[model samples]
Target chain A: EAGVAQSPRYKIIEKRQSVAFWCNPISGHATLYWYQQILGQGPKLLIQFQNNGVVDDSQLPKDRFSAERLKGVDSTLKIQPAKLEDSAVYLCASSLEGGESAIYFGEGSWLTVV
Target chain B: AQSVAQPEDQVNVAEGNPLTVKCTYSVSGNPYLFWYVQYPNRGLQFLLKYITGDNLVKGSYGFEAEFNKSQTSFHLKKPSALVSDSALYFCAVRLYTGRRALTFGSGTRLQVQP
Candidate 1:
């Protein structure tokens, strides 16, 4: 089985610019998630999707960040008017529908906003 | 609100010695605990989880974690540390009730010396 896939292992953008990260989860996985991991910190849940609908996104910055999983197999996270504080690693993970299942993760996209 | 806390920022241990990484969590309902490992420039990997059942759960790479419901702690442990086991470890928790989203700790960096 293939692992989760993420694009542009590294990215750099100026403040106020827009950036996007892509993620393709493991085949047959029913749940997908996006997380932000700042330096010296653990991964923070940005959003979670079960199939095409969102399960949770309470912690996401609604004003600047948005994510979608249209077909439910792949997802894209976007940040508009990126700020220096947004610089972090964007990690994507997938898992089964059950609450206790272990989640598989991708390599992640490292973003640096200057 | 569910939350996790890793008390130590870093831990140093000599190879072949025992190692432990402490974690504590808070939640309203039953808690689902997880441990993940991240190597340099890599995404988080599932180490183990404790949803229910036994108190001690063994996971990949000779890692194990003890779930203490009374103390609300799930500390990662290994009997004999290896140099290759040096990495960043994160502890996470989720509530069993509605709208479950993972709450992660800051993370603990493990350094194993030869």
Candidate 2:
């Protein structure tokens, strides 16, 4: 079976510019998630989507970051007015409908803000 | 609130030797523990998880994790380490109270020397 897919394995943007990352989850997966991983740190949960509906986004920076899973199959995470601190890898993962299922992650999109 | 801690920043072991990565967690309710491996410039891959049942859970690539409820810890272990096993490992935990998000540790880098 194919794993989760993401686009633009690497990205570079200047501060104050906007960037977007895309994710296509595994087939038949019902839950999707976005995470941010800074250097030397574990991936932090940014948002979660359960069939196009948000399950959790408490850690997301609403002032600059936003994500959406349209039709519950694909997702897009956007960061507007990017800052140097936004330089990190953005990972996407998917799992089955139930909460206890194992999550599969994509290779991730690395962003470097200069 | 739930959180995870990986006490070690790095672990070094000779090939064919046993390796251990320590982790501890804090949560209000029953904890669901997980372990993931991340190669350089890649997203995390699920290693194993402990939702319930046995204290020992074996997972992909000859990896295993021991869940100690009394100590609130779940440490990843492998009997024989390989050079290919060198990577970054993360420990995560979530509550069983229907909250679907996971709290992750800073991560541990494992280095296996030949």
Candidate 3:
């Protein structure tokens, strides 16, 4: 089976610009997640989707960040008016289910805001 | 809510020596614990997980983790360190309440000397 896939391996943009990253989860996986990893910090959950419906987004910076998993297959994370703090790696992951199944991650999209 | 902690910023060990990376977690309910490794400029790769069965869980790359309910910890261990094993390791937790997202620790950088 193919693993999760991501596009645009690296991107550098000025602050206030907008950028988007795409993700394709493994086939038959029902859960998708977006995580932001800042330097020297853990990867933080930005949002979660269960077959196209959002399950969580409490940590997402709604004011500047947005994500959607349409058709329950592929996902896109967007950062508008990107802040300097938004510079980090965006990781996309998917799993068969919640607790017991294995979760797999993509290579991630690296972003830098200048 | 759930959270993870990697107490060590980094761990150093010589090749062929045993190595351990410490992790602890907090949650109101029972947790599903996991360990992941991230190489430079890459996404996280699953190492192992502890759901319910044995206290010791083993996974990819000869890596294993021990789950301790009393200690509220899941520590990643390797029988013999290799230079290729030098990378950042992250601890994560997710609840069984149907939400499939994960909360990750700050990460531990492991440096295996040749």
Candidate 4:
């Protein structure tokens, strides 16, 4: 089976610019997630989507980051007026709608704000 | 809140020797544990998960984990290490606050010397 797919494997933008990352989850998977992995730290959940509806986004920075899943299949995460601290990898993952199920991740979209 | 911990920042083992990466989790009830590996510049790949019925969960690439409820630990082990086994390993727990989410630990870097 094919795994999750993400675009723009790498991106570099000037500080205070805007950038967007896209994700397409595995087929038939009902749960999707977006995570930010900064260097020297673990992955932190930016948002989660259960069939196009948000499940959790408490850790997300509402002032600069936003995400959406359309039709429960594809997701897009956007960051506006990016900061140098925002330079990290954005990971997209999918699972079969349960906590017990293992989540498979894409290669990740690397972001660098200069 | 449920969480997992990888206390070691890095682990070093010689090739052909046994290896162990420690992980511990904290949660309210029965916990679901997972192990994932991340190569440099790559996303997380699922290695194994412990949901129910089995304390010893085996996963890809000759990796296995033993779940100890008494200790609240799920430690990843390999009988014999290889140079290619070097990577960053993460321990995660499945949580159900409102919806399912996976919370990961800081990660342990495994280095194998041939």
lDDT of 2 by residue, A13-110 (tens): 99999999999999999899999999998889999999999999999999999999989899999999999999999999998876577788999999
Residue-level lDDT of model 1, residues A27-47, one tens digit each, is 999899999999999999999
User: What is the TM-score of model 1 when looking only at chain B?
Assistant: 0.97
**Candidate with the larger DockQ of 3 and 4:** 3
Please estimate how well model 4 matches the true structure, expressed as its whole-model Cα lDDT. Answer: 0.94
Steric clash pairs (candidate 4): none
Q: Is 1 or 2 the stronger prediction by lDDT? A: 1
Off by over 4 Å in 1: none
Best by DockQ: 3
**Model 1 agreement with the true structure over B14-94: per-residue lDDT tens digits:** 999999999999999899999999999999999999989999999999999999999999999999999999999999998
Between candidates 2 and 4, the TM-score winner = 4
* Each prediction's DockQ against the real complex: 0.76, 0.75, 0.80, 0.74
Comparing 2 and 4 by DockQ, which wins?
2
Encode model 3's per-residue lDDT on A1-114: one tens digit a residue. 899999989999999999999999999999999999998899888998999999889999999999998799999999999999898999999999757776799999999999
Instruction: Give lDDT tens digits, candidate 4, residues B1-39.
Output: 899989999999999999999999999877888999999
Each candidate: RMSD to true structure?
Answer: 1.0, 1.0, 1.0, 1.1
Candidate 3 deviant stretches above 4 angstroms: none
All candidates' chain B TM-scores are 0.97, 0.98, 0.97, 0.96
